[model samples]
Target: MDTQVIVLSVVADIVGLVSVILGFVAEKTKIKPSEIIVNDFVYCDYPTSSVLGMAISASLMLILAEVLIAIAGSCCGCCRTNAAGTGKSVVGIVLSVFSWFAFTTSFILFLVGAVNRGVNWQHLKIGDDCPLSSHLPGIFAGAAVLAFVAVSLGTAAAFLLAATPGSSSQYAQGVEMGRPQFQVPSNGTPPFNRPTI
Candidate 1:
């Protein structure tokens, strides 16, 4: 594997780990509940648990993919030539691609959820008879940002792995068959003596 590819894999792994941690934090952090009383009825606004759960699941998948890639890259010797090693790397790339999709979806969902929650809070404050204010915790926003970054890094790593040069079996076979790998210069174009036609 190329050094650049290795570097990319490492970066992806680090980002993935960070995203997982942030997702966990977001899941644990809860929005402060506030009540509004109107016409002798009480209403409370709470954070969306389902969205945070999805974020955690997606982040976990990203972490799994990144860890797998890092392990394969470290253990697979001469990935270009060894069929098993090459296959392992290919699997890693596929996992990374899946992780990218998951991360992207998670990020979008989190963002939309946060925005909607904010809008609802604003509407409650301005339009409702009983003014109430509640917003998502900062941890959720941080997790969304981390998930987005993880997607970018994971995608880059996958592309780098896919672009790695594979061993050329045909070139080796040609060399074994005593075939010139490159065209030799003609006598007229070289510094050697040329025979008369």
Candidate 2:
């Protein structure tokens, strides 16, 4: 329920969404196999697709969202004794790890996908007929899905980190035993207003 965590979570969610949208744009705008022209062993004619810019932008936003989530959640340390909050929970740790893994995979895919979209020519030519598009549409869509998954997991972990119910918080609540009251009650007049012990 902390304000900082809430704000960070919201921002991360927004950035993640934008990243996803941009990824979709890149997927849609990617260069098609039909568009690639083989120039008779000279050089392939690859259109200047918008996929590079969109994919890079998406990658950046995704990184920003992950960074924000990290700030909100602190670090993942499941070994800590406080399982209820901030870096000490098993679920949080799992979520964080999964998120990071997904982010890494997604980022690489985005870059590779951008490159595959004729943004960069065939690095190594093997029978060189536009170097096989490698199903660009599917790759981009998969990357976007991975990005969504990463953000989702990270957000869950951040909420867990913000739970705020750990050993320290419990200790601050003090003991449950009742103490003798020195003040007189409204319904009764005490012999003295001060404690004797």
**What local lDDT does model 2 show for residue 143?**
87
TM-score of 2: 0.72
Off by over 4 Å in 2: 40-42, 77-88, 116-129, 133-137, 167-197
CA-only RMSD, every prediction: 10.4, 11.1
What TM value does model 1 have?
A: 0.39
Q: Per-residue lDDT for 16-93 in model 1, tens only? A: 666666565554554444432333244433334444454545556555655555443432223444233465456645
Error of 2 at 21 (Å): 1.0
TM-score per candidate: 0.39, 0.72
Backbone clashes (count) for model 2 = 0
